[model samples]
Target: MFISFEGIDGSGKSTQARMLADALREAGHDVVLTREPGGSPGAEEIRRLVLEGDPDRWSAETEILLFTAARRDHLERVIEPALASGKVVICDRFADSTRMYQGLSRGDLRAVVDQLHSLMIKREPDLTILIDIDPATGLSRAKGRQGTEERFEDFGLGLQEKMRAGFLALSKEFAPRFRVIDGARDPQRVAQDVLETVQAELPG
Candidate 1:
């Protein structure tokens, strides 16, 4: 099984992704936990360029290219091999992120983002868990994190609100493969909800 957890920054998707990977491993399943923009060596290098530095470090179009390149490296080096070996790959984020982030940043270039994805990284997770949370709370939690990857968060609350909307809309558009979970609850509670959802989808 391949799974990806997604949400606005601070939606607890990464935490839940890790929890799910641990839970699955505890159940004797072969699982590989990884993340986007930097899952493999090459992509990690790209991650630094895109994630750190000034917010205006790259133009919207250039940023999209960088993200797509990183994703291609991640898929080739990390995601695909694990899946081929029959391990459950739980990724923190994937193409949906690029779709949503770039869509919001450059509305006119949304189509270009889609084209690049189709040409380079034409894959999707077997299941996607969308951690739905309000932008206010999400931003507050993100602000508490200590990291140089704050470029996206630096977009501020308004941008986050728009991202939240975009993500929710994506969940609907891809409802067949998406499981939306409320992320505003306690961490344990939210993790449990995610576990149950994933467990139900697991084969006997």
Candidate 2:
């Protein structure tokens, strides 16, 4: 199975992704836990370029290209191989992130993002878990970590709010494979919900 987690910077999707991978592995599922912008070695290099530096380092259009390039490398080198070998691939973030961050944050470049995805990537997770939360709380949580990848977090609460709405909209648009989960609860509680949701969809 292929799965991707999506949400604003501090929505705990990454934590949930890790929890899911670990849980599945414990159950004897072969799993690959990864993240976008930096999954494979080549993509990891691209990750630093786009994720660090100033928030204004790259415009939306420029970011779209950079992210796509990274994603292509990741898909080719990591995601596809794991999936083909029957391992569950749990990814921290995926193209939907690009759709919101680079597509909506700076302008309406969603079409551009979609076009590139269809042309280059042409793959979507069998399921997507969107951990939805309030922008203020999400940003607070994100900033609390104080990691170096603060480029998006530094965009302020305004961008986080917009990204939250955008992700919710994407869930509806991709309803069949999208699962929306409330992420405002305690981490363990949230992981329980995530695990249940994923379990239901696991192959019988």
Models 1 onward score TM values of: 0.97, 0.98
Q: Please give the range of 10 consecutive residues that has the lowest summed lDDT in model 1.
A: 101-110
Model 2: which ten-residue window has the lowest total lDDT?
50-59
Task: Report the lDDT tens digits of candidate 1 across residue range 64-156.
Answer: 999999999999998999999988999999999988888565566778888998999999889999999999999999989978899999989
Clashes of 1: 0
TM-score (C-alpha) between model 1 and the true structure: 0.97
* Deviation from native of the Cα of residue 102 in model 1, angstroms: 1.0
TM-score of 2: 0.98
The per-model lDDT (C-alpha) reads 0.91, 0.94
| Residue-by-residue lDDT tens digits, candidate 2, 56-172 | 998899999999999999999999999899899999999999999998889999999999999999999999999999999999999999899899999999999999999999999
- Give the Cα error of residue 8 in candidate 1, in Å: 0.5
